[model samples]
Target: MFARASEDGFIHDMVLYYGKTTLEAHDVPLKPEQEGLGATSQIVSVLASTMSFPTTTAIFADSFFTSLELVRYLQDHNCRYTGTARDNRIGKPQLGTIKEMEKKAVPRGTCYYVTSDDGILAVRWKDNKTVILLSTDMGEGPMSTVLKYCSESKKREPVGCPAVTRSYKANLGGIDKSHQVLPMKSNRRYLRLFAYVIDVSLTNAWVVYKRDCKALGVKCQPLKDFKL
Candidate 1:
């Protein structure tokens, strides 16, 4: 599912598939979670249809949608991912704990990357809090740094961050924007589903329309006007 940050509240390119089947009731080596991970990879494959060679695409997702397995899957497909991950996820790096880092006098905005046996890079950074990110598409060097306010220091300072972190922070807003603009708050489940389909369609169309207008150097039509 694709969502714009805080604007449309619409989920785009959503594909639904049932998990339970007569075959599933019999013999399957993979666990249900593995099946779900495979399904998620397929969704990403569908979303990457427009991508071409040498033009890398990055997927940003929350912890629920990210794992080392998922990172490898995208890497195999020539894509990259940046997402929050739980510490316990399999193959996740044993980065130093927040306490350990604090004890070591690690400064805010400091970032470290650990490469797994499979060559996937896991990034750990200290901000207001410790953040762990899994990535396949980021380089070792920091692309740029940003000034982030540190409460302890009571001042803002330039913090070095990896490219994946920067891109994730920038692009993370699409889903949030979608949620704000077209909130899918319906009591009835069926109505909710119906609203989701409509809202996604409308939001996707609007995004394309706005992009085309920008490319052509024309003013974008208002949402009301575009809907008409």
Candidate 2:
């Protein structure tokens, strides 16, 4: 399943994975450039179409749903996106190689970034491991500091973190949080998808209820009580 969720864990929309043929049969539109992309990219495109354009909706996702083409597509549609990217999916940007980034001589917080002509930024940063991120709305500058445990010194120390990385880390858990609140139980083989759909419906309704309560200045119950 693929879902578009808010930072506070409100699920806006979702699509069950039914393969490319099903998507085509449903007449889901895809740009010419997006035609041959992987299934994950296609899913992103379909979910994004459900959103209103030019709202500056910031999308945060993991490597499974991020690619250079998808980032470009989001940018063209006036949406902002930041996500971890697989090295191969980022194209041959003039960024450091994994070997160079992992060398002993390199500093732990070292970072390199390059912006494409179309204004997509690809950032490569080193912490305990190398992380490559892509963004349409962030830059390399104005870095933030994050606390990291230093095993050698046995103390926690501050490490420089890129803005894109920081944003992705902050916003990437919406779907996971949504799942935690409305977990689905194991069911008979044919009933599994139906159970998942019911859970998602309940979660979305619960989120909207909480929002309405807050807006109306009314006290809200916990999800368990609200469900009852």
Task: Give me the displacement of residue 65 in model 1, in angstroms.
Answer: 1.3
**Predictions in order: lDDT:** 0.64, 0.84
- Candidate 1 stretches greater than 4 Å from native: 1-12, 16-56, 90-94, 102-104, 225-228
Q: What lDDT tens digits, residue by residue, belong to model 2 across residues 73-136?
A: 8788788889998999999999999899999999899999999999999999999999999998
Model 2: residues >4 Å from true position, as ranges? 25-27, 31-33
In every candidate, how many clashes are there?
A: 21, 0
What lDDT score goes with residue 137 in model 1?
A: 66
TM-score of model number 2: 0.91
What TM-score fits each model?
0.74, 0.91
Clashing pairs in 2: none
